[model samples]
Target chain A: MNRYGLKEKIELRINHATHHIEVDVRDTLLDALRDQLGLTGTKRGCDMGECGACTVLMDGKPINSCMLLAVDVMGRNIMTIEGLAQDELHPIQQAFVENGAVQCGFCTPGMILTAKAFLDHCSNPTDDDVRQAISGNLCRCTGYRKIVEAILDAASRLRRGKRHV
Target chain B: MKTFEYITPETIDEALELLGEGAQILAGGTDLLGEMKRGLATPKRLINLKGIQGLADIRSIPDGFLTIGSLATLSHLAEHPLVAQHYPLLIEALQRTASPQIRNIATVGGNLCQRPRCWYYRHSAFPCIRKHGEGCFAMGGQDRYHAIFGGHRCFIVHPSDLAPALMALDAEVRIAHADDSRIVPLTDFFVGPRDSLTQENILTRQEILTAIRIPVPPDNAYGTYLKVSERKATDFALASVAVSIAWLDTQVTHARVVLGGVAPVPWRVKQVEEMLIGDELSGKRIERACERAVDDATPLRHNRYKVALVKGLLRKALHAAHRSREKGEK
Candidate 1:
């Protein structure tokens, strides 16, 4: 039986960098990434899993970071928004820019990550599939039309092997 | 959130033994963590069950039932081939649930055991009867989302879309305790506020739900789940209905009608089921049966809309099931 108030040491591989961090047992992955590691690119919106701003890739699956405990995700590979751009923009990121899908940009990271996961599973998708894929990421600024178009454009680019990253 | 020790038990026996006093089981943490952030529950120890192996598998038992481990994610269940072909009602309800990200993380057991989303119960300021308070604030306050059936002292509704669907499918749950294990019908799982003001279900502190078993669908069985929520997604249902029927050509042989979002539990209307059985699912017959769906509903002041909403949902579900059965025959 574990005792309360014990700080646990957890290691996470974020953006290909492994870090050993100490956190309270109740600390969420969102808090560890934003507060401890200073990866503030993943925004925290609604924190209660209602909003998708805190989405990140865990083992290639997009999940809400705000709802996951850091200790629970020990030794897992997490890809945050900061990891998306190494030297150049990822294909999804470029599509968001060219299609003018980034307005205020709060929901952009989550939208892109969710689209990335969806596109990985479905190479050729329809308009309805794109809509269903990004239904979790809500954007009040772009009215979602541009975001949908950007994802479709990204899907075509990836299918054509135009952009690998 | 309050400070608590997180224990990831590797075995079910270890997890059950750890869940004694001042301990709560943590599956998805989609609901428990939020409740903790809101100062609702301050458990001293959190028994994280994610480390246990073989608890998340979905398998078909030979000559028995389809067993779904409690830890199976909602998204996985929604997309499983067997669920799509055999249990369309569950798929429909899961697709209409919270957004993709939440479904990816939220587990089936966690969804079934999650607490009510009543504003009074969630807010720390209200201190309603569900929170061991003196009275129910939603009785006279903002009660647009309260229950319309099986509510006496409290007026909160069950917030699970899968529960009503499971009830309609005649599912059962396997509960594990330290001493022994037992199987319970999904219909008898939930407890109302009139029965106990504190606990929502019959799960004791020592017990943990292990898996859910769904019997094979009968011949020519058709099922559908319809939900009417305030929003398209990520919102609790205003009212929902799950209809499952075994049709013999144009006549209904067996039927199960379970209602949600307007009752303390998944409300099973036996009268409606009886009315549907042995009768052809005609438009007038469905309309008349739906009219009686809310005959025992005692809607609160602000939720009288749910009475009409439930009827409409029932009618729509019945029609959808009929259409699905027709499409299957082709």
Candidate 2:
């Protein structure tokens, strides 16, 4: 039903699955992900782009979904917190849980996604590097100490997993 | 945000034809979407520029210039090898910009054309002069983050970190219209409150910024960007300095000192540059340059600290540039 109006039916390839959804041109990618697709894992914090709570992986790069229009990201690969785990918690998620990084659990999704994207490129990173990488994702809780520790822990864990493979 | 029609044009011709009153160009939507959400900007139509090809390329031209398309994301440019090798000062500024998430989505054109971060203008209730209102509320109201120089009727500072860095490098921008395009120096691209009360730049409604071109710096040229903020990460600069200097052994030959977060435009202090040129970057010379940097600064009630901040930043940046020369070559 694309009649060149305010609403258009667009296909979003989310989490290795494609879904056709009718969205308003004004709907942000965050709105479409949470309201339409029922992906509540991507929290809506400060609907503005200030807070990175609505961050997701747009083609494996962490971006604030709240700043993007749904129509603009039609065919891009969108990955939310829901897509991070298969049967068990992903290594990043496991490290977060093990290191007490999830205090209020509000900033965990965005923080993990940002950390995942950072660790993917940098197999070994210093504490300052991790801090600079995830500066966008703000966490009022945990004071970012445990979160930073968890990310470093996850990096080593991922490296061990790769060596085992 | 109100409901608006969105169209992605595939070519610059089609995009320019669609651009007019009541229409806004959507490059990355990092700034426009925020404005739309805050009701600071309301458009009847959005012309998304993502579909346009060849607008996001970063390449070195044959004319000894590095041309970057407008739609190129800030993160991509920051990570580009050419940018790192040629213009490290830009990378320094970009690393301190908004955040990783923002850098991933914010475009160079969008960053340059982004609206002011003044709280009074951002709020719809204020209706300040920049919003086509009667007077500026920050002139008397809370203006700790307001401009300290080149502010007349408006005190909002230009918020782009890239602008000052690019200005320090003697960059130019390409502006396209419906029929043809023209190149303008980056220094002339910005418009202060003395010229226009409602707009920040000289871009017309039908014009679009296509790309930015920066000349290849000389081998002896050294550049550095220093920003002072309340927080270490994810915060705008209170006062920033970008210094580009070329030296002949121990004496400065060419210099550009541009200050940000202190004026309606990227404030270039010719007095400081004049003091620096043909002189060795001695400790006493840096002190004199810092003094000249704040001679004409007209700070408001609450932004007097910015004058000091800019002075300190200029001192630090000049010292860094001086140290770079002592460490052999770039």
Candidate 3:
């Protein structure tokens, strides 16, 4: 209770591939992802849950990491934009650049992460599916048409891979 | 934000034991933490209910009750096949609340228990009746999206669309105390601002809302919920309705009509229910029922548009429900 404003012991594993950290329960997942763990890929745009700038996957589902408390995600497996690329760009990231989906690149990480989550669930998505997939992410410099193209193009590649195998 | 003590209890009893007058129980933190950061809601202690064991499950109980855990996210409710099949009104309401990202972290319990979205209430400078001060400034200030029914001390409409749909489905609450539990109807869950001007719910500070139970209606029931708002989505409803009609071969055997964004609570319509009883849902009957929706509405200066909007949406919703009754499972 006496150490660094911690009233209770909180054992957390954030961006777990990198490090194990201990934080207070009051700290949000966005804080742990940005400040403590230095996994700044998760942007902190709106501290409120209005924007999807802080989107992350907890146990394979997309959620607002800003609205989530660090202690709430204690034992849950977390995946961020950093976890998506392992010295190699993911298919969605590749498609984003190939289709000119990213502009200003501030909202790209969150949009790409949201797309990855959707593609993980659905391989063959229609235009409406692509629109619905990234409906939460807001691109101010606005590359929606390109984002939809990238997701549909990636869906084709993924489906072709499955058919070849 | 000022630093406060945090506790994550794994059981309802433990969470209740930690709650007190100024201690807030954290369901989803979608509302509480944002308020804390803005200096709008300053609770001394935050009791996190996430670590609790059974507060996240959604299952059907015996006696035709669909029990929804308090920790069940709005995203789950929006996509759950069972909820969509049984209560389409509820699904539509959940679909229209905020964005997909916000729904992922917002809890079903917290959605109903949320404070008003009034800019003044969040700003804390208006000295509104909600802040335990003088009268609301929205009365004389820019009051575009204020109240139209059953609002006196404060004129903020309820922000939750899911709350109205759930109320129309005859939902019940499971409030867990330290050593006991109690069940109350969803309509009776909220207290008016004129009643207390501070407290929004009837539950004590120590009671944790464990679960919600929605009674299962008959199999051949048709329901439609619609909200007419300003934006395409991600905005609160200017006016909303959840109408569930039990269709027996052709006629509406049973009807539950409830309105949202018209008052501080879900603002049920008893006159509409009485008007629709034992009558076939023709175009004229639907129009008659829609007219009765705003019979008791006392619209404020800027909110008079809501009455006509509410009438049109209810008429459209009734027609949609009637079409669904004839179409059978789209």
> What TM-score fits each model?
0.97, 0.99, 0.94
DockQ of each: 0.63, 0.64, 0.46
Colliding residue pairs in candidate 1: none
Please tell me what DockQ candidate 1 reaches: 0.63
Of 1 and 2, which scores higher on TM-score?
2
Would candidate 2 be rated incorrect, acceptable, medium or high by CAPRI criteria? medium
Q: How far off is residue B40 in model 3, in Å?
A: 1.5
Local distance difference test values of all predictions, in order: 0.89, 0.91, 0.82
List runs of model 1 lying over 4 Å from the truth: A1-5, A162-165, B326-330
Candidate 2: segments with Cα more than 4 A from true spot: A1-3
**In lDDT terms, how accurate is model 2?**
0.91
The sequence of per-residue lDDT tens digits that candidate 2 reaches over residues B1-330 is 888878888888888988888998889998899999988889888888888899999999999999999999999999999999999999999998998999999999999998899999988899788888889999789999999899998899999898999999999999999878999999999999999988889999999999999999976999999998888777888999999999888889999999998999999999889889998999999999999999998989998999889888988888888888999767
User: Fraction of the real A/B interface contacts present in each candidate?
Assistant: 0.68, 0.74, 0.45
Ranking by TM-score: 2, 1, 3
In angstroms, give how far residue B117 of model 3 lies from its true place: 0.8
lDDT by residue for model 1 (B1-330), tens: 878877888889999989878999999889998999999989998998888898988988897688999999998899889898788889989998888988988999998899989898999998788888889998778989999999988988999999999999999999999989999999989999778888888999999998999998889998888999877778889999998999888889989999989988889999999999997888899999999899998988999999999999888888887787778751
Better of 2 and 3 by DockQ: 2
Q: What is the interface RMSD of each candidate, in Å?
A: 2.2, 2.9, 3.8
RMSD of each: 1.7, 1.3, 2.3
